[model samples]
Target: MENLHNDIYPAIDPSVTKSLHQPGKVVLITGAGRGLGRSIAEQYAYACVASIIICARTSTELDEVEASINKINSAVKVTKFQLDVTSETAVKQCFEAVKEKEGRLDVLVNNAGASLEWVSIDESEPGKWWNVMEVNLKGPYLLLQAFLPLLVETARSNNTVVDVVNISSIAALLTFPQSSAYQLSKAALLRLTEFVDVEYKDKGVNAVGLHPGGVVTKLSENNDAIRPYLIDTPALCGGFTVWLTKGARTWLGGRYAAVTWNVDKLLSMEEEIVKGDKLKVKLVV
Candidate 1:
């Protein structure tokens, strides 16, 4: 066994700040209009990513996020697309545009999701419950299906690693009354991450599921029933995502991680975690 204390729990160094720089990379982020998605885009901009394509259902929100990113780094090529992730045709068009304009995509962030009514299973409206699934699980499925070929192609041609970062939630692991629909959707999303990684790992494409923590965003504000639990900042997930994409982090591929985990500590435990195949969804025998 590894000495976790000496190896993993080192003191934080206040003087060191981590940043990722991918000057020619192109990233596409769904739900990039606000909150966690917006923060993630901003971090990528700061990292000097060459091109960023942001898509969401609202044009106004997308425009605002684009402007914010440009202000951080005017050199970054920012493209805004108003998209409905639930619509396969719309997702296809978005990726087509990315391929036409950018030629290749380095990262795809499936951040768009919905958590409609927070009622118990029995009380939940059938249409609303299913809508959550449509956005949370089905949307990513559509995007991943549409984008995998392009990601794999880019990786093979350039000999570089590509990524799919699914913004999952801790709700996937924990159960709470009145939120079964959201919980089930996220749990399925985590499984999707594993499935994609397993299928595409050999092709230089990596997929990861991440719990963005309890960022107080419009998604949570709209659901006053769960506002008290929202405590983390969007920047936490945003910065962590840039870190995840900086290197292949092959050891962490197909796994689910929490933004609350310290990056340095997690890196320290990489060997042990990978050896044991930890931090992934498992059947509790």
Candidate 2:
């Protein structure tokens, strides 16, 4: 099999021309303190997004990301919130805070995730499996439930589409050894993405799942099971995310995409992708 991580994709360079400009659009990214999440936030800052709400469990990390984004563009409003996405109450309060401050939310990136144990099914404990599910799957569900009202209202009032980008993984599609928990969670996440798109597309809310490639992040670097694979830069996912937000790509809702795939190449095949029902999760009969 071809190595999925071997492919090179475009990176988001601050010096290059910005392709996504959401001048007054407000975006909220969970787990945005570092790694791919931080890269995503920085990409948005360069695109001149009006307000960016970054949330994570650590205040110090959040502070650093906020400061970094501010240094890049002083005008880009950065709000750092210490949040544990696994908590329903915290998710509710965070959304309420964003509602009070921004009046609306234009984009939501459910990027918080964890892989507790990489052991095979026989060796995996229930507690460890549940931990992965709670963070990767349930966290996004709670976030969507809490933020949907604001997203719907914003899309209706503004005559624009709201976006929900779930940071999923290629593990959801391929069967890899000793990755039961992480793979299950990601698979369910893709289903949740599809359900959100089907239920809310008519209301102007679009949702999609993104496989961020095998990026060398703290998560992957620490996991001995996956550290040896060829990895892509976090900027690949960051740039692809910005491209996903553009209105022209609304048809991509309900689909799953990989950052390893070139954005321009993906866009060029948009019509065929939609018509063929490609890039969507389906059970192979």
Clash number by candidate, in order: 0, 0
- lDDT (10s digit) by residue, model 2, range 1-285: 232333334333432655567689899999898988998998888879899999999999999999989887889999988999999999999988999999999999999989865787888898878999999999999999999999999999999999999999988997888888899899999999999999998989989999987878777777876777636777777777877886636789899998777666677798999999998888678
Q: Per-residue alpha-carbon lDDT of model 1 for 1-285, expressed as tens digits?
A: 231221112122111333367778999999999999998898888778899999899999999998998898899999999899999999989889888998899999999989876787788899989999999999999999999999999999999899999999989998888889899999999999999999999999989999997877878888876678687778777777887888788888999988778777789899999999998889878
- Give candidate 2's root-mean-square deviation (CA, Å): 2.4
lDDT of 2 at 132: 92
Report lDDT (CA) for all predictions: 0.86, 0.86
lDDT of 1: 0.86
Model 1 regions more than 4 Å off: 1-19, 222-225
What pairs collide in candidate 1?
Answer: none
Candidate 2 has what TM-score? 0.94
Q: What is the lDDT, from 0 to 100, of the residue 209 in candidate 1?
A: 97
